[model samples]
Target: MKKPDLISELNTAINQNIIIEKNIKEIIDMSFKIFKKLFDEFGLELEKLCDFKYSSYYSKHKNIDLDLAIVKYFPKKDVKYKEFLEKILDTLKNLPYGYKIRKEQNDGYIAISQETSSKIINYRFIFLVRKKTKTGYCDYYNRNGIWQEDYALELTKSFSLANKISNGTLYKVKSLLNYVLKDQFKYNYGCDAILITWFYEFFSRSLNKYLDNKYNKKEKELDFVNFTKIKNLKKWFKYNIDINNLYYFIFTKIGETNTYYYPELSFEPLELFEGITRYSVNTNTFFKLPLSYFSHIKVFDLRNYQDVRLIQEMGGEEYGYSKKAWSKARDEDKRYFVSPFIISGPFNYAMFKKWYVLTSNSLFKTLPVEIKKDLNSLRQRESMEFLNMTGHNWISSYYAKLKYLQPYFDKKYPLIKERDLKVLIRMITTMVDKTKQSDWLLENDN
Candidate 1:
């Protein structure tokens, strides 16, 4: 698994058209031409108001379908930046390609779309403002003549809870507090602050009750506790918990599950307050869009593709939800977790085999034998769990049934092979590793 050998194999795979590398390159070339034309027309006008640059060059290299650019504008003494934004939107609308634009109040981006060869491609140009306190910048919202960043930062500094509290339990506490305090605060003092205050009180009372139940016969000296009575609680909370980690969890969860597609625009509306934030694990930064800006943009249905439609006929949609099914689930419950399946199981298995070949050349070689054994054990356990959940025995009977079903299976139960299960585990674990090291917002002027 030398680097050179891996590169050669990858090149061979591309030459054979084993993946969608050719299609990706064609789209990237098309997107670049559109981006360059826009920059040529209004780059100078944009520069006069703020720092403007392209932000999705790295994304083009990945197997995604969208492109993005960003403009960072600092609030000036008396200049009207909103007017400039409107001018940009007007220019986009006037393009010969018939680009459609979508804008939102207090939002950080303008979404644009165009159709080419019967397929729609989406582009986003995010607007960012410089932060007042530091050299860094973030998306801000205007509230009562004041600009405020994400409330997560403020809430992180206000809560004092035991380090032993699990993240799952803390999330439930936050949800409960938010619901109870919504009517009382109503954005006057910020919902997060109100939630944190009451959450601290609730946690203290719960802990006291648990302690009393455990030591019913024993006489123990205890002092009455409250959030206000605790000295240096904010400092303790800051020292104990990493805010970045908490924000990362919240951001990733929202980006994955909390989205709705606008029927008119054919894309999801971007809003920072509505949990549309993207967190880059590598840089520890949060932005207003997902790593793949067009991931949730559904201009065409998955069934429209011939290959995907055939797979869906074979119970692809039943094995896991499609993008449309996922959106429908969100409509039913915004908090529902839906994992979308667009590619077929066999195709995924092939890709996973290729990925395992590439990584085994380097990463697997570096791990200790014991760790490798543990990973194999984990792969086995997960495979069994998946089989049990999917109700697939993966034996002779399963294969016989699959043959009888032909290209279509009963929608009630989907099935897969037992041997492909290991590859699936490898694929998921590798993706998680890559996400942790992803530079989703890499800027490239060239």
Candidate 2:
């Protein structure tokens, strides 16, 4: 796993890429030169240790060609890793737009800003680099390419620079040797090893498959960027990778499902980023908040609010009254017969604009006095029925604060018993003062 040994393994892989007439020593010398030129241009620096594997290297599958890719796992606290990656990207001008360097944090795998479009083109970047054994091959491959079957590796190991330069796992002994040489050489050597592994496992498969199918095969060539293909690839990855799999244990401390309030159906705010991020790759904003907040309660509680039950609730209307006639108040006795619900029309743009104004104002003003008093005194608020008559309406807080006197009116006077408006107002002030005094006494208890 030292830089020289890694240079040796890469030399073996590069020999397969193009026709090389030079001897092995000369081939390695030029290979490093070619790599350094490409490496410096790309701004990639390898970690002190990493892992690499080659697929189809010894197989008779000529059509398989080279499947190669590199996965660079940065430390959770290493903020400088990001800037280093950006520098490499600046140097490597020829890397296709689809060429992405993803930063997989605890929250989720975020592709570096420049690499959004690169995902579809470079399918291997999203996957984990598992040590490929004979049986493990299927776990690494999906519709797009090989993905890491296990996310647990992040928790169990610390990857060193020497692990990166070798075609297999690295140990302490070889890593120390690499460190003694130009320590930067260890980083560069590891970079080459990852590049070789990536080319042999992931990249070669994609490039070779496309070439063979595009020019030689009789089958319909797939546009790799096709929505249907992309969707299928995404679905395939989701089905195979268990959500419990952890990537970077420190930064990605939580899985998306564990942190998710509802994991069965993904309604997370980041999903909105997926929807718009596809079309407008430059977008940093997500659309999840509006959709979650505005989601209809009926749709959310589908079983309880079925159409059959709704129809039963609404059937009290007399056959004599047209639906339109029910729109206006008729006899005061008819109030019990009328359905209070109103359905807004599709494309009700004007209504939406008006509702936005009303709803925005309501949130601040609509706290009920009892609820406010409870919150102020006890640091907890009272719950309402959530039947948004008062709940959804703006300025209802002011009305709720008015405090109903219907019970007092019924008790105080039997006939012509409208409560004096002035008396009700005075009661509210008196009650507020009394509640404040009560709250202070309660607070003193603890």
By lDDT, the best candidate is 1
Which ten-residue region of model 2 has the weakest summed lDDT? 291-300
Candidate 2 lDDT by residue in tens digits, 159-202: 22212322222222122122122121111222222222221222
Model 2 TM-score relative to the real fold: 0.16
The residue-level lDDT of candidate 1 at 284 comes to 19
Q: Per-residue lDDT tens digits of candidate 1, residues 1-446?
A: 43232222322322232123456547646655665576567642121110001111112122222324333345554324576567567666645556666774344446566555545555545333344543234434333234444322122222223212322233332332222222121111122222232233233333333334443224332232332233433333334433323322332223232222211111122221122122222221111121111111011123235534433443222122244544543354322222222211111111122223343244335545654465447454433333222211111222222122111112222332222323433342244336421122223311
Question: What TM-score does prediction 1 earn?
Answer: 0.28
lDDT of 1: 0.32
TM per candidate:
0.28, 0.16
Screening candidate 1 with a backbone cut-off below 3 angstroms (N, C-alpha, C), the clashing residue pairs are none
